[model samples]
Target: MLTRLELAKDWVRDAGNFLKENISSPLEITEKTRYDDLVTNFDKEVQEQLVSNILHHFPEDKILAEEDDEKIKFDPEIPHLWILDPIDGTTNFIVQKDNFAIMLAYYEFGVGKFGLILDVMKDKLYWCDSHKAFCNQKELESKKMSLDKSLLGVNSYMYRTNSGGLLDLSHQTLGVRIIGSAGISYGQLLEGKILGYFSNLQPWDYAAGSIIAEKIGFVTLTTSGEKPRFNCREQVFTAPAYLVSEIQKYIKS
Candidate 1:
């Protein structure tokens, strides 16, 4: 699994480099479900490259990814599965040429084995395997901090709508940060820069980050305060176990 994890990291790094190389190039962009929900040509290109490489190395593995032909449903019967978001923040990549990420998570027999998130411009590859989490090559240290003493990441939509009392919850935190990218936001959480995060996320959006977060004593749960169902889009929140109920109090419906 370590060997595969290393290979996966290499693949994500290559994808990140690819994105960086094209940052200034003109791109063909389009909307997905909404005008603000964007996808760019690079998004498809990166996803294709990563998915192709994965199948070449592990032909039998099933993939659930964001892009053409790769957005298939997960099948638990499959021995090996990969969840990928080729460019996690496409709008950011297109608009700012930064803050986007390449994220991938590997699972075996329905259990997570490895997860990788490469912050493209920052060149930080945050990753975790069964035993540990790291940024680049340095191991991460975990510290427990109270919600009130920490900044929290919130989805702008949730904050705007005050969905499930998100507005009230944000007031309890030291501050609120809405980083448009889940991969980047989770990286911040792992670094102890934030105590928690609440957002509506798809499987690819949270899979890699959640695995790495869990490796460092954080728990990713549904907004309802139950275990997350990774097979579908859901409202998700993540924080240390001690802070769960407190944060969930205002957000969980």
Candidate 2:
């Protein structure tokens, strides 16, 4: 019998394998809202697979997945719930064929228990619990980095359009990276390659990574400095502590 954590990890690995096998093939793509926001057959397939697997194994738990139109409302009284993003960087998956991820997180009454962010191309899995974070089984620790030494992640659309208070924050960082995928940017933050990442992101983009970041002793929050609310419909920005404060100042100025 597998524990819940074991089951979650296995599901992620299986999903990643499924993605790798299919990623190179021709994908049927369609635009959602705009050309920059994309969805593919593979994305829906993966989401369906994950949802079915989880529901089959844990029927009592609630699920919040990106592909579904109707949100699965959970009673806060329920002890367990799962949040999933079948493919975090759908546009990247459609365009570049790399730099995308399968993101998952489990929470207990709004308290995060475990998180998994699998970088499909690199075949690296970033996972963590309350104790620590690991990349491919190697323990990871948060490193201190200042604004001038930092590399920040912002979406190209946000940077170009100056949407949602992003332009001022972009200018303050040492350098800005329009990575197109929040999952990839989150990996960069965990590996110490980047100091911060901020953008108007959805719950799927930030839930798993934010839990991992917090576990490893890094600060994770919205640009407004509020802790993220799980199953939220609002857009959010996440980053390390120093950058959050710095960017807040920049936005004010």
lDDT of 1 by residue, 1-253 (tens): 5477878988888888887877889999988889999999898899889989998889988898877543666766669999999998888888888898899999887788889999989989999879999999999878978767889898998888898688898888788998899988988988888888789999888889889988888888888877777777788988887777777678766
Model 1 worst lDDT window (10 residues) = 68-77
**Candidate 1 lDDT for residue 177:** 91
In angstroms, the error of model 2 at 235 is 4.4
What would the TM-score be for candidate 2 when compared with the true structure?
0.91
Query: What TM-score, computed on C-alpha atoms, does each candidate reach?
Result: 0.96, 0.91
Error of 2 at 29 (Å): 1.6
Which number leads on TM-score? 1
Model 2 lDDT tens row, 1-78: 997778888888999999888878999998887967789999899899898989899898888888888977644676
Those runs of model 1 whose alpha carbons end farther than 4 Å from true positions after fitting are: none
